[model samples]
Target: MFDWTRSCAYDEQQKRRFHTTARSRLKKLAAELALPPGSYDVRSNKAGVAVSGEVTLHHTAVYIQVGQFGMSSGHGILIRTCKGRKNYTGGANHFVALSMLDDIPALAAAVRAITGVGRADADSADRRAA
Candidate 1:
């Protein structure tokens, strides 16, 4: 005898909890990154929050979006970036889509590099060059 209804309820509850946790962590990370407060817009969706912000790196402006989703007791983050446009760019116009969770730190590092921060002591010259 299987209880499908009970299983679905449990799954939903777990998803809600995961979403909450993920949203909190994202806000914390944004603060740690020194990104201007309120510079990013966070909107709640069925899965999680949609975070959008403009990060300037290497003198180029980039539009960033992160869609977070909950799965079981864990969460997933979807990172996307778009080149700045003088006018509105339609959806799905991202220059990059980073789907792996493990790649998040690397992606963050890239952003930092672009923003002229987080360079190695030896690489200060490179940053200055940029």
Candidate 2:
């Protein structure tokens, strides 16, 4: 037999803990990236943690949203990107959380991919030569 009320309370507690840990990690990541001040925003609450920022990719501006919610291994990241459309262009679905310090490199790479930071420069140069 299981108690639904108790389960719900436990779930809420887990969410709170996850949100706190994720928010702390998000702030650390922002500082580690060292982007221009006020370039990106970090938001956290009982719900979850989110990092939204703008980056110029190949002469175009893009918005990137990354965050985490819940506390299951099933819990993962949500990355949403948009250019100028009402809907996102291409983004990730719920896969798995990658917030561990050991996973920072992968997280950073994902950020670069979405922002097209360093990679965009190389890509633009190749296109100009072609």
lDDT for every model? 0.37, 0.42
> Model 2 over residues 34-101: C-alpha lDDT tens digits?
44455555554343222111121111223333333233452345544444434445544323344333
Q: Over the stretch 7-120, how does candidate 1's per-residue lDDT look in tens digits?
A: 223355644544454355455445444556445544444432232112212111333433322333232343334333332342342233323223444545555544443333
Error of 2 at 53 (Å): 20
Q: Can you list the residue pairs that collide in candidate 1?
A: 57-114
Deviation in Å, model 1, residue 77 alpha carbon: 2.4
Model 2 — TM-score against the truth? 0.47
Off by over 4 Å in 2: 1-9, 45-75, 83-96, 99-102, 118-130
- Over 4 Å off, model 1: 1-10, 47-75, 83-107, 110-130
The local distance difference test score of model 2 is 0.42
Candidate RMSDs in Å, in order, are 10.0, 10.2
- Kindly provide the TM-score of model 1 when superposed on the true structure, using C-alpha atoms: 0.41
